[model samples]
Target: MTAPDSSAPLGVFDSGVGGLTVVRALRELLPDESIIYLGDTARVPYGSKSPDTIRRFSVEDTQFLVGHGVKAVIVACNTATAHALPLLQSTFRVPVIGVLEPGVEATLSDPNCERVGIIGTAGTIRSSAYQYALAMRKPGLQIHAIPTPLLVPFVEEGWTDHPALESVLHEYLTPLLDKGVDTLVLGCTHYPLLVPLLKKMLGDQLRLVDSASTCAAHVKTLLEAQNLLRLPGEKPTLDIYLTDLAEQAEALAKRFLGSTFNKVKKATL
Candidate 1:
């Protein structure tokens, strides 16, 4: 397959609207590059799915993006990244980027951090991707992972600070705090929305690592290194596609991207 032109849009896929955080970062970092984002809302929350199912969904998402002539593909879902990144990288001709390694890199960057905590969906936690990556990088590093599956739904519902949500957060984070974790990685893109609440609860001592911006910076570096960076100072088009119709996706896209998306269409695998 021939490499796409520099002007070709970059593709980004996620299980749902959570990937918009990545899109926000990409737009801030690469203002002139067009983007094609695919959200598999029809099968949202790959966090509970089997590894095989995640891989299959990721492949279809890649194919859908490739069909649109994307210059590269970004797997913006941590769950999908945990389960399917290697396969996506090997199977696709375009560059494939995942959220896991970038977030892990960010987490390990803090020199003072002795114990690290990670919070994500069940699939990501079950995959143990963060633990394995950290171990491979630093065998002696201490890591703790907790699955906060309910957080996704809470974020989607715009309930970032509901009393019930706080109860759940306390329940999920108390154990990690007890473990003396000085740094916390928001392992899922959706979790960024809860940062304010998290900071209020965890306080200043606990550093929060947001993968969205880190992954975006990595994408910029990769594009520049490959001589695939687009021209600057131009307004770029963003094409939005979802496997199923989701009103919240559009609303959240506007919230995260800081602009209204004029075109959103339903797609199928």
Candidate 2:
């Protein structure tokens, strides 16, 4: 197939509104580009689902975006990317980018990050995607990944600074801290929302790798190299779809996009 038109909108998907964090980064780095984001709100927590189910939902999300003539796809959900990125790349024509590799790359890019740590949902940590990716980049790399499953729901409830949140974070991060990890990878896109609190609890001295920003940077580089970047000064468009609860997704999108969405509608898979 011919290379996608420079004006084609880039596609992005997540199990839910958490993916908007990625869209936030993309807009910052590539302000002229159009974007279509799909949130599978009906299946919000892909982290707990089986790999087969996650893969199925991911394909449906990708196909839905492809139907909208997206030039490339971003698997913004760490769990979905961990389970289905390979299949999506092999089956799709456009570039398929996942949040995982970019985060790993960002973590290793820092020279002071010798003992790297990662925190994610149960499924993401169980997949060992970050560990494997880090090892591939640096054999014998000291890595620690812990599943802080509670953090997701906490963020959804807007409970960032609650006493309970601090307790849970300490419980989840103490082991990695003890292991002398100097850097932490926010493996789940949703985790970035808790950064200020995380830094407060873990101390400013610890470096944090935000996968969403790194993934967006990677997308910018790819678009530039392929000459697929949209021209500057164009008023970029954003169309968002959610499998369920469009209102909820719309409400949450404001937090991620830093503004109200221009178009938000309910759509299936």
For each predicted model, how many residue pairs clash, with residues at least 3 apart or on different chains? 0, 0
lDDT of 1 by residue, 28-145 (tens): 8898999999999999879878899999999999999999999999999998999899999999899999988888888778777678899988888889999999888877788999
Best by lDDT: 2
- Model 1 lDDT, full chain set: 0.88
| Ten contiguous residues minimizing lDDT sum, candidate 2 | 245-254
Query: Tens digits of per-residue lDDT for model 2 on 1-269?
Result: 78788899999999988889999999888889999999898887898899999999999999999989999999999999999999999999998999998888888897666898899989999999999999988887899888988998888777878999999999998899899988989999888888889878777758999889999999998998889998877689999888887555666777766777776888865
Model 1 error, position 36 (Å):
0.5
TM-score for candidate 2, please give it.
0.96
Which window of ten consecutive residues has the lowest lDDT sum in model 1? 249-258
TM-score per candidate: 0.95, 0.96
**C-alpha lDDT of all candidate models, in order:** 0.88, 0.89
For model 1, the stretches where C-alpha displacement exceeds 4 angstroms are none
